[model samples]
Target: MSLSRTAMLLALVLSGAQAGQTVVAIRGEDFLINGKPTLEGRTWRKHDVEGLLPNSRMVQGIFDDLNPETARQWAYPDTGTWDAERNTREFVAAMKAWREHGLLAFTLNLQGGSPQGYSKNQPWHNSAFDESGVLREAYLVRLKAILDEADRLGMAVILGYFYFGQDEHLKDEAAVIHATDAATDWIVKRGYRHVLVEINNECDVRYDHAILKPERVHELIDRVKRRSAEAGVPLLASTSYGGGSLPGPKVVKAADFLLLHGNGVKGPEAIRSMVERTRKMEGYRGQPIVFNEDDHFDFEMENNHFTAATAAGASWGYFDFRMKDEGFAEGFQSVPVDWSISSERKKGFFRLLAEMSGEGK
Candidate 1:
């Protein structure tokens, strides 16, 4: 019980609880991984360190306005060569840094950001995903290249297809409407099997971010699944919405797994409440639990929450952007990060969970 956060997180990564382990059905009470009655706390990281928001609504809410300030803060400036090679290289390096902590990287592609002419807005309009000006082939080739690197590294990439329209352009949930067949074709055509597409970002229910009506989101998945089936691939659609339980507004059957976005919830309070609430829901009683995105230093909560969730029968997904002294990885620089652990140490909290599961014994 006496261990640092870094040590604990690594334990989770090395816990021998992989994605495709055994038949421990996503439902029921207390699951087991790889035939062993071990807890499944899947520690991982995301590649948003360079300013792209993968699965968090904070970035979407901030960037939805198309404000220059948030743009610059996210590092999606109009600078850098207006091509995918440079873009891919930048992300590849970042992803490599994350894997060093024994975590998986999730990539994002915002529709707003692009290089010079590629972007519609002048100056800062350019973003990491401004493909309007870049050669279509160049963009596809480079994108696939980044995905290949991710696939090679055994990491997951949450292809950011769109963001909330908080900025001037204001695409938000409505952007999906403009997502033409060509774009959908591109998502399915030019990528490896590892590619997973998230149709929407942190879409709020209280405030409509042009959200794809739940039925539409559901339809989108069906369409994508059909296309993915033709290519022998499984397509994934996700959203970062508020959490209450399977009974809440976010309880839609569009995605393959259960996902939730977290704020800076104090300790395991929100997590515990979220789980209990989920258990009370009809379909989510024993579903796969994914903390798709959240703020850092929640290591204590992560450590404690993951244990609580699996015991109640579920799986957890951890994410980070940078490996800075891993109590939890930091995505944006402005968010002060604690260097209590090494930049590359991710086993701080989960490390204990791993020991409990008898991993590395």
Candidate 2:
């Protein structure tokens, strides 16, 4: 095929592939889907619920272990075999439940999070980008399935490109950059309007390359924004920080929305405090402050992280990981996840989400 003809055909194919179902955008401190504010005009206990995005960290939705040694570890209890397709299939099937419970968003990483939750070392190779930074088709196929479903349901996806533990899988700085460019191109060409690009999971964590670190990670955020802008897709981009840490001045300025984590934060009051302190930072210009990952949950209480964040005009996300004795139905980040709202903890979070989002109405 002629080069120009090939390019034209590619554009047509890409345009027809997904059909651009949902559109997510930021307007000052609010999130808008399809030109209207999220949860428009709603209030939860005197807090303005309009424009806030309630989310959860479900990073392993497209998870797969390439290392033979570790691949066997995620085997289902019933099947006694690990199946990446089944993992994503189950994840897709569970999305409606989450959406019905008033979840407007969820985080899914290209390089999946540590199946062990918090680990000093990650031996499993679970990245969607190869060492040379090329996109893996198998992973993208699964991700497309999830993103397509989220689009149909009007849910926004905080699509993350790299996780700290998995970023080391890329060979060097160039590979990281290549991976970012490639991922950005793919998302843009796919015509997904519901996707928010998170350049990396936590910029403050230990990363193999300096560019992916906190000081310079904003460069990648800007890169994604630039590339997407050139393509006319214009994805909203940001990188997150470690638990309870405030975003730096550089990212606060570059990012379209500020992403926060509440894992290391101690209490509900601390959660409220983090949101308060973030607004006072140098480059903060009233962008939507969203906690896309927080392991805390006290849904039955009078006040908790969720309550506190909403009260402070910030959005909150639930990060559930199965404890040592917990079963399949426990954690959303753990491998071989039971994506259903099965356990008490999962129920508590969704129950509160439903009540607040007025899904229970």
Candidate 3:
């Protein structure tokens, strides 16, 4: 076996994680997998890559639309049909390649993000929770399979519980709270140590529920932490803000780590400034700052969102969506995704990732 593989196995054993499971922990501003810093001892271009969790946004990995009317929209070209099982199978098959390309983590949402990448109005019913905030068994089964695979590969999952576009699925605030507690309970029961809880994607975005909004979102975050701690699993939890905005005092104080987005932010300098401003925000603590959903990418450039975030001591994530006139091979967020490392855009991101994470060497 390779030395890295041996070390990973040893780490898993030492950390008391079950066989074929990944354990994620936070140490100050560093992210640790099985008690060891991610990208251990690695640096790129005078930037400290060690301890950073390089990730991407793959929110729709196990996506399925419960609404049959809209389900047909995500049909694969080859099969001319939409199969959630096939989508998940292909997603799992591509994960090892993603890991090989130096991706340590990715974001997944139960209520998936916009299938159109950035939709103004979401008419599709795509939620894992029912109107009562109970998780559907079908979705849980698929989620378990994905989480199991992520564990076996030694990768961390930033598992998001809600998304703005799909929040209407839950009936009310009570249901939202129930979903949060239920999700947390499910994760604990499943014995997943490598999962971080993202309460909602972009809490400041349009949401039907007030509990999911920025001011009160921390209540859910604190609830997740409390519920998980009571269960003895103690999962790390947080919520993210919209692009270029600083996290409010509540989230800043309550979150285990800060999650940011670069979707609407412009330029590398702006990215750096966002990170800087976050660090100085009220109730700011020295937790790891992560940009888990950034749509900007200029991988070949000396400075970009990825580079700028890293230089400012924040981990960055790639959020690629199907742009106008792009084919299936282009975007990870677009429906009917080609999960392989196909297309120039995909190759560019992974190529730079490999170089930065020392995977190429």
Candidate 4:
């Protein structure tokens, strides 16, 4: 095996030594899988994650795009029934490319909300739950495929369980809880150590269902942890906020690691301030903090976010979406994602990541 792969396997083995089950653990601002520090011996701090890329809403259209009508037609296509063969192929390909370019983490949503306000026929509403409340078999198959590929590639997946706008489709709060239990149970049964659970994409966002509103989101996080404990799987769990907001004290205390967003953050200074303010929150326990979603543009400004985040000893994530006039040229966050290392933005981000993390030398 290659050195990176060997190191990853060793880490998994070490972390799973206790219960003989692969798991991810939080240890003082670092993420450990099978007891070995992730991105170890890199330029950044011992447990800091440096190569997060812009892959928000990946699960939304990944399968739907296979439909004949949508087949690469729209910017974000949605035209077909879920096809396991093609979905797995495309997902694995994108993931492999990401791993090759030093991206160790990406965000995926089970139910993707509309970036533009919700519409009657939003193509990206391909949620994992069906109208009857059971987990969609097709979604589970694709999810497992992605998780399995992530485990093999030594990468981690920040799996968001729900998204705004589309979450109301579920039958009720009982359905939501059942879905959570089912998802967590499946992960534990499969022994995946590279998955982190985000109960909702942005807990503070408007939701038709009261169960998932910001006030009670902490309960979902707790449920995830409890279910993992029941299954004997050590999983990392947290929820994210909308841009320019910090999680509430209940959320701060519930999450194993803190997840922040940069949607409306003004610049690097704002990013730094948010990180600092979060660290000083009433219930803050000094867990690893990460900006898993941000849409700020420009190389200098983007660099400012990265620099500020790393300087504050926090991790950062890139958020890009496809706009009408601008093709995918900017670094990190552009839309109609090629998923390959095709854009200058992707190349620049990976190159900077290599320098920052001391990987791909």
**Which has the greatest lDDT?**
2
Residue 28 lDDT in candidate 3? 91
**How well does model 1 score by local distance difference test?**
0.40
Give the per-residue lDDT digits (tens) of candidate 3, residues 60-127: 98688888788898989888998776677778788889999899999999998999999999989888
Better of 2 and 3 by lDDT: 2
lDDT rank, highest first? Answer: 2, 3, 4, 1
List clash counts for every candidate, in order.
38, 0, 0, 7
**What is the per-residue lDDT of model 1 for residues 1-361, given as tens digits with 9 covering 90 to 100?**
1224323422322223222212212123322222333224433331112111122111210122134453343343345212223334444454454444433335355442221111233334422233322223334444544555566655555565544331223344333434523445665564444445555544443224334444345555566666666765446555545433232334444555555644454445666666566556554534444565544444444355444443444334443344334322333211122212234324443353233333331
Q: Is candidate 2 or candidate 4 better by lDDT?
A: 2
Clashing pairs in 3: none
Q: After best superposition, candidate 2 residue 156: deviation in angstroms? A: 0.5
Q: Please give the lDDT score at residue 19 for candidate 1.
A: 28
Top TM-score: which candidate number?
2
Off-target runs (Cα >4 Å) in candidate 2 are 1-18
Assess every candidate by TM-score. Answer: 0.57, 0.95, 0.94, 0.81
| Candidate 3 error regions (>4 Å) | 1-20
Question: Model 3's lDDT to the true fold?
Answer: 0.88
lDDT of 4: 0.66
In candidate 4, clashing pairs total 7
